[model samples]
Target: MPEYRRSLDIYQGYNYKKDKQTPVGYLTKIKVAGTDLTVDQTCKDPTNPTTDLKCVAVLSGALWETGVTDAVYLSGQVSAPNRQTLASLIINSLTSVEVVYQFAVYDYDPVAKKYYLAFHANQTDMNGLLEKRGEDLNVSVADDASTEVQSPINYSFQIGIKPQPSAQTLHIATADQKNVVKSWGLALG
Candidate 1:
C-alpha cells in the first residue's frame, strides 16, 4: 500500500472580556462552527507507473477544551464515485497524500482564566474497515488582561501512513498573542 501524509488547519476565535468576572467553576465551551476539506494529488505512485492513482482522502477531527466541555467532532469524506478507486491506489503504492481541513472554534466561556485546547483527527480506509488512525494537537491558553478578544489558532498535523497510520507531528499557533498568554504542543504522538 502507498504511504499517505495528512495535515490539519484549525482556526479558533472568541469574544471575551478579561475584566468580566467569571462565575465560580466556570468552564469554557469551544464549538465547531464549520469545516472545509481539500485534497491535493501531487504525483503518481513510483511503484506502479501504469495506472494513474489518486488518493482516497477523508477528514475527521474533534475539538476538546480541557476541564471544560465535551468534545465536538466533524468528518468530511470524499464522494462515493472516487472512494473505491482512491482506496485501491492508496493500498497499492507508497504514495503520499495531503489532506487539509479548515474548522472554526468558538469559545463559550471566554471569561475563564485558563484553558487548554485539544484537537484530534482520525483517518481510515474508504470502507472504514481498516484500523483507525488518529492525531492529537494541544495548546495552553491564559488571559490576564481585561479586554475582549477575537483570534484564530491554526493547527497542522503531519501524518505518516504505515501498517498503522500515525501522526508525525502537530503544529499549533495563534495570531492573537495578547489573549493567548501561552501556547504549545503538549507532545508529539
Candidate 2:
C-alpha cells in the first residue's frame, strides 16, 4: 500500500478568438471540496515504470487495437461552486481551442518523500458538455417524509484518456523544476 496523488492537467492554449493565449498548462488540483475522503483510482495501476510506458514499450492490444481508452471517473461529491467552474472551463476548448486535458496519477516514492507522476492523458474525441455535473430538478410528487434519509449527490463525469508519454516521463525525468512553468496565461506568473 502506497500513498498516491492524482491530478488533472488542462492544456493552456489560445483563447476562443485565437488572438491571445489563455492560461498555459495549469495542473488542476482535482479534489472534492468539503468532503475529506480520498477519491478512487480511475485508470489501471501503471505497469513497471522502469520497463513499461516508454515509446514502443508495449507489444499489442486485443486484435488490431494498439491502445485502449482509459476512463477517468469523478466523484459526485464535488461541490456546486467547483462544478460551475468546471463547466466554464470545459466551454469552447473541445474544438477551436484545441485544449488537451491530461490526468496524472502519481506514485508516492517514500524514499524521496515526494510524489512522482505515473499515468497521464490528454483530451480526445469527446464533447466537453458531456462532462456535466448533476443539476437540480423540481418534482411535484416527492417521497414521503418517513422515507429514507436524503442521499448525497453522487453524479459524476467521465474523461476518456490515452496515456500521456511525454508529460508523464518528463515529470520524473526533469532534473529540476525551474524549466517547468509555474503558472501561465495573461499573468505568466
- Highest TM-score model number: 2
Per-residue CA lDDT of model 2 for 11-111, tens digit only, reads 11101122222211212233221121223212122222222221100101111011222223321222234334445444424332212332333334445
lDDT of each: 0.24, 0.24
In candidate 2, list every pair of residues with a backbone clash: none
Kindly provide the TM-score of model 2 when superposed on the true structure, using C-alpha atoms: 0.26
Model 2 lowest lDDT segment of ten:
55-64
lDDT of 1 at 80: 34
The residue ranges of model 1 lying beyond 4 angstroms of the native Cα positions read 1-60, 63-78, 97-107, 110-189
What ranges in model 2 sit over 4 Å off?
1-66, 70-79, 85-99, 121-189
- Tens digit of lDDT per residue, candidate 1, span 1-189? 211122221111111233432211111111111112223222222122233323322222332232111122332233333333333433454222322323222122334334222222212121101112453222111222112211212122222211223222322222212233122112236
Task: Name every residue pair that clashes in candidate 1.
Answer: 1-91, 2-93, 2-94, 2-95, 3-94, 3-95, 19-146
